[model samples]
Target: MQQGSGSLVELLLSADNFYELVSTIQYLDVIQSRNSEAVSELVSLTDELALTQASLNAQMDEAEAEKQRADEARDEAEEARDQLEAKIAAQAAAEAAARKAAIEAAQRAAELAAQSEQQTPTFTTESGNDATVEVPDLPDPDIVVPDSDKDAFVSEWSARIDAYLAGSPLAGQGTTFAEAAWEYGCDPRLSPAISTVESSTGRVCFLPHNAWGWGSSSWSSWEEAIWAHVAGLAAGYGGQLTYAGAQKYCPPNADAWYASVLANMLSI
Candidate 1:
């Protein structure tokens, strides 16, 4: 009976062990199921993190591209501005240089005029009397226009004078000479003919603006010299063209001078 009881207890313990083993196996299965769910969740989270990282990287690259474009645009704008400023500065400098050159030219012209004014000539009357002829302060050339009588005289003689002086330095002064002759009651052809004889129509002169070789004279401008010489001729030579006048004017070569002057007057 004791052996039978021991056998029954061993069977009961074995059955309990079998029940515990079954319970432990079911717990392990539950743990495995939970672990599988957790692993799926972790894998899903890792995939989501990788996607987020990829999106961040793409955004960063786009932002970098935008910054580079903005930088390039800024550089282009700066370059354009610099080129525009340089052009403006160059134009201003050129204008300033032109103004400086004009001022220098005007100053030089004034200096030459002042130098000429320092040397002038004295005149002699037909009666062999020495005289200091004062130049009339004539009106400016811009303001002076010939009247009807002077205009007629200029029209008649201007073309002739221009033709005679075409290749000479005294070219283009026909109207000035004609107008001065009319104003001073001198022969229009007398002064120009004398210029041809003495100074080769102002191609050469012993003094500044002394085209007629009247004396040791210098004038600031040709207009002033023309008027002064005409006035002197009217004062001393009776404003006429004559052999007597030529003899009194240049006794050393009166015949040749008079003949040349007559021929020039006839040609005119």
Candidate 2:
């Protein structure tokens, strides 16, 4: 029925209908054009949004990579710091141990020196001549036979002592003692002197194995004494000792004790 009514109105209003139809056609055309433009703008905006999203994703990836790199660097730095700290700790420990050992050695030496006055020092020489001597004792007659008459004394005593030790026991019996004395590479006359001076004229040295004044308890045997003696002489006289710069072992006075000790060796 509504369609029939619209048909009757169309037939009755011809001129009015033409004008209305033209206006409606013009409005529809404008509306359709505006709608098309809006659709195109929307599509363009969507493309731009997609591009922006892609760019944001790339930036996020780069930022994540940078963060990962920074974290790795921090971890490496921490590891390096830890290693340095460990090395420092180890060095400190080693220094402490060295200091402790030095302290212990010094203490032992002090104790030994204090307790060894009453007892005599004793040890066998490399030449196989064994005689007990007192610490800081009177001079032996054999050693007292002056250096000027040293040759004759050496010849006479060497022959006698060699015979006694090697089974002769006669002064002019044979020259075996002289040969043994010579074999020891040190003077036989000086040997008695060394013993007497250190062991106290057959009384006591009481220091463990320091009979010939050759060692200070750190040395163990006669061989060590011999080597130490030889080395000491060369080094002491030739300015080879580390402490004695530009001068040999001979120094004046008891104040320079290390040097004085070096000089006294010749007397022994």
> Best candidate per lDDT, number?
1
What TM-score does each of the candidates earn? 0.44, 0.36
lDDT by residue (192-234, candidate 2, tens digit) is 3333334432234444434444445435543344345434433
Q: What is the lDDT of residue 184 in candidate 2?
A: 39
Q: What is the C-alpha lDDT of each candidate?
A: 0.65, 0.42
The lDDT, on a scale of 0 to 1, for candidate 1 is 0.65
Which portions of model 1 show Cα errors greater than 4 Å?
1-148
On the 0 to 100 scale, the lDDT of residue 41 in model 2 is 93
Note the clash tally of each candidate. 0, 21
